[model samples]
Target: MSTTTETLKSQWEALKAENPHMRIRNAAEKLGVSEAELVATSIGEGVTRLRPEFAAILTEVEKLSKVMALTRNDECVHERKGVYLNPDFSSPHAGLFVGEDIDLRIFLSAWDKAYAVVEKGEDRDKKSLQFFGKDGLAIHKIYTTRDSNDAAFDVIVEQFKSDNQSNEETTVAVPLDIDEKPDSEIDVDGFKAAWIDLKDTHEFFGMLRKFGVTRTQALRLAPSEEHAHKIEKDAIVKMLEGAAAQKLPIMCFVGNRGNIQIHTGLVRKTMWHNNWFNVMDPDFNLHLDMDKIAQTWIVRKPTEDGVVTAIEVFNEMGEIIVQFFGKRKPGIPELTEWRELVASL
Candidate 1:
């Protein structure tokens, strides 16, 4: 090991000894390094580096049977327990795992580093496959549950293990500075027309791109009050509580730069832990830091079936923390109860 790596490893060990319960992500932030770098320090210990063949590795994930799929941004964490099925990698830039319980939208281009990790647990070893973005932050993670196929997990580890097992520090990319165009320059009339004429929710991104306006900016400049309007951030909590109380099946989406994990079902238990609001359900869990939310918008988009409504939450950085929509697929109109619930907010 190089002098620098040895120094980092020593520092990491000292930190862990001092704060054994600290998560590696927090430890990395404290040590002024990437989480991937900290995990790399244990390359030959409990961590095995995996090749960047993310799509292929994901294709083999189904063999492990039931696992927990986790995706998070800075403000929210989404976890869903399900089988990895229906692997689709036809697109070079992206992929999808369209299972009923665990649904994911994967962006292959953002995937950079991967590792197969095992940690000693109370009863047995905890196993997981973690993938990271170019920024050295985790994009997605799959953890083996008690019912998971341990033998299949071992097979996958051996199959895609990287030839290089060096504990090299991960490279962190410089944060991108994407400045949104001034709203004054946008064609308000044209943008509103396009938004009104939208047929699918998926076309929303294209409309934003066409107008060169950011998500929050578009919300602020919504042509009509019915189209979009700001609401109190606390509405998120109320929404969850209302959904749980009414047994309303809702869709919650949380994602970062690389992946978006969706949970389309009922949210049963809702509670608060410190500043974080949580949805503690059997098959799905969501931890959202309420303090990070800066703005909440009730956005309505026109669709062929009817108008679709969504509760979109954003952080101070103008990044989406989480989005809630009525559990409905294409060709279906928005649920009246959901629309009423959002309108009540």
Candidate 2:
């Protein structure tokens, strides 16, 4: 068979390999359900029937197919084994999202990697929701409507592993800086000036700390907390300088209304294995657990800032972990559907 044909076969086997006794969502933390479709698929293929309400699945599944293609072979080190999937999902319905890629090690010990995608648009006669996996495997599911958390399609991959049959994965994050922060390696006034001016790349993270902002708390900002708890200059600078020391990769993203997200990169070694801070194989891929890394980034701060903010950090990945963003002003950048579609990891 040709490469594409072989690839399809591999994916089909992978999908079929999933235990029918288990739900479509492998992780208990999975945010959505497939019980209805799961029943449809288990009913011996063609014999399976779809409820009138199930028409939604077809449209969304189509969108999901398109989205999965976007994530193929993208670069992301923080991504856990199961494609760096969620450790504890809060969304009521499960949908594969293509935002910032995560480090699976931060959440689970033995990460099970899988490709994630989701369906989009609404039209039963038009499109359907589709999900795919790593081996170019595609499984189409129908969905009439989606909850806010729906974004992509995904699967738990640990059961296929010889050693990971019974164990669960937990996500953990690693800090970038190895050296302790000196009280002196901080400056909030400078950061404050940066926030107000919005010109020149001024770092305001230091001041955030003065307002009692901390690396520990920075990662917990909610989806709607665009401007959550504004902090003083000193606090912001301290957090920036301190986080930069670890050389952590910032975890920001573009969200609703073209918002730019600015958050700390507590999950170190997520980009390239920091030769200065990590150990790796001959390929130099950091051997650290990715599940742990993702938990570190997510648990640390909620995604803040606007779309421009995430792109800025995306290009700058080094000792200096800086973040400065604003709302959608004319010249300022905002989040975009394409940016999320192109995310790495």
Candidate 3:
């Protein structure tokens, strides 16, 4: 129970290989175990083994990477272009898509419980899980359930306290900027949508706090804005927290239109992205490991035109973490060019 999957399986396999003629029961005895246990353990080990599909996919991705060599000579990594800032406040690994509301009693609730499990395994430090979905989605979650009187929940709750989850104090209710008004003249819904779009996703609620967008403006801004507005972020979170109890339409940004819409039929889903983020507090563990932590990118073309290579991280659990869309970081003048383009936009 406290051994590596490889170590346990190796023992089992050695016994089986040494005596291929022995009966299954005899093989179990050779491994100093019961036949049922041996059989179940083998099956479990097989499940954890990377699937053939995954192995082949990895091989193919590696092969595709060779194309990076046949390109122009602008290989210098620049400041803005080469900088890969780690956004640790964002959830690690895996992107999930949420179709509808889900019962949180199991996977979602259980995950909040399981995180406290003793770090009983190897250094998953180099490993980042890639969940395939947006920031807030979670699919195929196996959760622990509890009723009103379920005493087990107490034990789980205690574990959280024993762990570091509760050790740190958090504060909310940020001081509003002078520019932030008590109210605005925009239509409540339309303005909210507009505000949400104009806000930044990776930054704190800067647009709302700094730009003085009203709730309606924030909401409107989110759908079409380049970033998230405070109200929009808060609204999305409220839907996620109560998802286990009731299903609600998780608002998704529909292209360039600033319209908000909801999807349904969520059951143990896991497709979400961590869009809103910020760094704060006495200690900055929030930003500890910011970039390229077990992330992957999909291989686009070997090379694209004048651009030699480009890459971005993906959170698909089994898919490659980062994919090169254009040129690799470190450019001659693209950084300045990009800054000017963004500013112009």
- Point to the candidate with the largest lDDT: 1
Worst 10-residue lDDT window for candidate 3 reads 70-79
Model 2 spans > 4 angstroms off: 1-113, 116-184, 200-345
Tens digit per residue, CA lDDT, model 3, 214-246: 323343343432232122223222333343234
> What lDDT score belongs to each candidate, Candidate 1 first?
0.91, 0.27, 0.25
Writing each residue's lDDT as its tens digit, candidate 1 over 80-130 gives 999999989998766898878989899988889999999988898999999
**Backbone collision tally, model 2:** 107
Cα lDDT tens digits, model 2, 183-213, are 3454444533334443322233553455343
Candidates arranged by TM-score, highest first: 1, 2, 3
**Of the pair 1 and 2, which is ahead by TM-score?**
1
Clashes of 3: 79
The RMSD of every model to the true structure, in order and in angstroms, is 1.2, 19.2, 22.6
Alpha carbon RMSD to native, model 1: 1.2
TM-scores of the candidates in the order shown: 0.97, 0.22, 0.18
Error of 2 at 28 (Å): 3.8
